[model samples]
Target: MTIKSLGNPYDGDVDLRHGLACNCSDCADDAGHRMKAVSARDQRTRMSTDDMLDRAVESAIVRSMFGHNELSRRSFAKMLGGTTLAAALASVLPIDKVKAAILDEIGTPEKTDLSVGFVPITCATPIIMAEPLGFYQRYGLNVEVVKTAGWAVARDKSLNGEYDASHMLTPMPLAITLGAGSTATPFLMPAVENINGQAIVLHNDHRDKHEDVSTWRGLTFGVPFEYSMHNFLLRYYVAEAGLDPDRDIQIRVVPPPEMVANLRAGNIDGFLSPDPFNQRAVWEEIGFIHILTKDIWEGHPCCAFACSQAFAETYPNTYGNLLKAIIDATQYASDSANRSEIAEAIAPTNYLNQPVPVIEQVLTGRFADGLGNVRDEPNRIDFDPFPWHSMGVWILTQMKRWGYIEGDIDYAAVAEQVYLAADCGKVMADLGLEVPAETYKSHVIMGKTFDPAEPEAYVESFAIRRT
Candidate 1:
C-alpha cells in the first residue's frame, strides 16, 4: 500500500504508526482497517523528497504545540479533528510562514550575540575578516571573534560551550567527533576557511640540508595539534622519505602564535604550520619556507568554521546565518582583487598581530621565500568554503593509518555526519556560488592518489603506519 492510499491524519484517521496486524485491539475491532500493511520502504518510495521534508516540518510544529507529548497530541487530534486543529492553529499562528522559515532557515536568529574563537593565523582569514568586513553584521549577528592561544583551547572552549563556534583545523572536527583528542562531542564543519595556506619552514641554519629530506634524521618539529593536517602531512611527507615520523623525529604540539617564537629560540628546528606564522618566520629572518603544503597536496583543506551539533540544532537560524556569513566572507576572500584589502583588514594587533607587509605577502602570494629569491604563487593560500566529504575521509584514513583511531571505522558515515556537505551546498546555491556536483572525489597527495572508496586499502598501503 502507498501513503496516498492511507487515510490522512488531518481527517482524524490517525494511525500513522499502526499496521493491519490483527493482534492489536484497535485493529481487531475495526473491520474496515484490515487492509495490508504498508511497509516503511514503500511509504518512503511513494513520497517525494520535498514531500518528506514538508511532512517533517509539519510534524515538528504539531509536536511542539503539544509540548512534545505524543498522548496529548493524539488525543487533541482525535477530539478536534486534525483539519480543524490545523486551521485553528493556522489562523492564530503563521503556520505556512513558520514552515517556510524552518525549511529555508530564513527566520530571525535565536541568539544574536555570540563568541567565536580563532587562532591568530592566516588560516582564520575568513572568520576574522568577516567581522571587520561586515559579513556577520550583514547577516544580523553580533559576533565577537576571540583570539585563542591555540587549537587545544579552541577545542575545549567549543566543547564546553564557551564558544558558540570556532575556527578549527580540518581534522579537528573529525577528531573531536570521534573523541580522539577530547570528549566525543558531535561537531559540525559546515565550511572550510582556507585551503593550501600552510608550509613547512626549517630554521635558516638548516639551509645547507634543505634540498634533501633523507639527511634530516634527528630533527624536532612542531605542529599546532596532533589532529591537524600539519602533523598528518608532515608525517606523510617524511614517511615517504624513509623516516618514521614517530621514531626518526620528535613532533611537539606548539600553538600557531608560539611557532615562530619557538623556532627563534631554537626550541624547534622547523615547523609545518599555518600562515602568517610561517610567513612571520621568514619576516623575522629565522626560517625559510622549505615547501608550500600546496606542493604536498594542492588545494588541501586547512582551517574551518565549526560548532557543536547541539549548537546547530538549538540555534538553527542563528547557525544558518552564521554559515551564510562565513561562506560569504570566504568567497569574498577568494577573489584575488580583494586580497590586499583583506590583508590590511586582518593584520592589526587584534587580528593576526603581524605587520601589514607580512600579511600582505602571504595573502597576495608574492613574497620572499627567505632564501634570497622572491616567488609568486597566487594559489599559495586561497579560500573556498565547501567542506568536501572526501577530505574528511582522507583525514580519517590518516587517523587510522597512524593509530590515532582504532579499528572498524565506517569512514563514509562518519565523514558525512561531520562534514555537512549537503547543508553547505544549500547555502552556496542560495548565494549563487558554484557548488560541486559531488562531495566525494579522488585526491592526489605527494604523487599518490587517495581513493575515498578504498580507505582500508589506502591505510594498509602505507608501510610506515602505526596500525
Candidate 2:
C-alpha cells in the first residue's frame, strides 16, 4: 500500500522516502511503516494513560466517601448516574458539606488539552492570557486558547461542542439557555473575565458633537452581537437620548475586527464595540472613542467564560480546575502592575492579533481618546471573575425591554441557574478573593435604577423601549 504524505507551505515538505529504498544508510527496512505504526500505538497509549489516571481518581473518591462500602458505593454510582448519585449522597449528607467536600477533593480532571474559544478583544483578558501566562498549566490542565472569528461563531462552536468552553458575552449564556436566538440548552457562565471594557466609538468626523446624541439621527452604528453588553449599552445610551434604536438609527452587527474598517469605509458612522477595536480605531485615526461603557453603568459585566451545563456535570473536576485557573488569572489581571505584561502576552497573532501598544492602551486605561487628549481612567477595563446574578437579571430586563424575549420571564430563577454564582462564590472564596455577601446588587444604567426584584417594572421604566 502506498501512503500519501501531507505537507503545507507553513511546515515545509514531507519526507516520503523511508527505509528499504532509502538513500540514507542509517535507515532501517520499511521505516515509514514502522513510524506510522508507532504513531498509532502512541496515540492509544496516551488515551489509556488518561483513562487509567481518571479511574484511579474515581476509586480514591469512592474510598473517601464510602469507607468500608467502597464496592457498594461504586455499584450504586454505576447503577444510578453520577448526577443522581451526588443527589442521593446530598440527601444523607448536608448539601453544603457535600459541596465543600467535593471542592476540596476534586480529583484528576476528566479531560485535559481543552480548546476554549474567544473573540480577540480586551474583554477576554484572563482567558486569552491564561495560555501564555501558564495559569491553565498551573492548575494541572492543558488549554488551547483558540482565537475565533466572531461572537456568533464562538457561540455556535460552543453549542455544537466544537469548543469545550468559550469566551462569551455576559448575556449570551442566558439568551442561549432561554433559546432566544438558538436552540434551548442549559448553558452556564461560571466567571466573568472582564468588566467595563467596552466603548462606543464614533467616526473622526463626529468628534465635535459629543453631548447631543439625539441630533445625530439616522446614523449607522455597529455592535459585535445582539446578545452582547455592547448592544445593550449602546441601546440604553441612544434610548436615553430619545432615539428609538430599532427605528431611529441603523445598528448593524459587525465583528470587532471589521469595526474600524467599516468606519473608515463609511459603512458605519460608529460602533459600540469591545476594545482593542475602539483603541485600534483611534490608533489608526479612523474613529474617536465617544464614551466608555463603564461610564454608562459602572462595574457592568461584559465577556464571560462559559460552558454548557452538560460539560460541567460530565467533567466536574476538570470544570472546577478550569474555574480556579481562570479565577487566579483574573486576580492577576486585576492588578495594575500586571496590565502591561498581560497586554504583551495576549497581543500576538495566535491570540488577539493586534498591535501591542493598542492592547496596552486598552488595558492600562490611559488612552488617546482620538480627540487629541490623553484620558487617565484606570478603571476603564477591569478583571472581576464573579458571575453576579444581578448582572443576569439586568440583561434579562434589557432582553425583554428590546423585545428579544417575550412573555413573563422568571428572571431570578434563570439568573441563578445560568450564572452559577454559588459555585463561582465558592471558587472565589477558596482563592482568598473578595466575595460579595449577596449574589444580587442593584445597578443604575443611564440614571435609572434597576431593581433585580422588579425586572418587569424596569423594562416598563424605559420610555423608548421596544415593548
Considering every candidate listed, which one attains the maximal lDDT?
A: 1
Deviation from native of the Cα of residue 34 in model 2, angstroms: 28
Query: Which portions of model 2 miss their true places by more than 4 Å?
Result: 1-106
- List per-prediction Cα lDDT, in the order shown: 0.83, 0.78
Model 1, span 374-443: residue lDDT tens: 9999999999999999999999999999989997999999999999999899999998999999999999
User: For candidate 2, lDDT tens digit of each residue in 1-467?
Assistant: 11111111011111211211222322344354435433344334443524333322332333346431323544655577556775775577574554345435555677876888989899898988776555564455556777798988998999999999999999999999999999999999999989898888999888766778997698999999999988988988988888999999999999998999899999999999999999999999988888899989999999999999999999998999899888888998999887887876677666777888999998898899988999999999999988889999999999999989999889999999999888889988988988998999888877778889888888897788878
Error of 2 at 372 (Å): 0.9
Determine which window of 10 residues in candidate 2 has minimal summed lDDT.
3-12
RMSD of 2: 13.4
Q: How many backbone clashes does candidate 1 have?
A: 0
TM-score of 1: 0.78
Model 1 CA lDDT for position 217: 91
Model 2, position 370: C-alpha lDDT score:
87
Candidate 1, which segments miss by more than 4 Å at Cα?
Answer: 1-105
Roughly what TM-score does model 2 have, to 2 decimal places?
A: 0.79
What lDDT score is found at residue 204 in candidate 2? 84
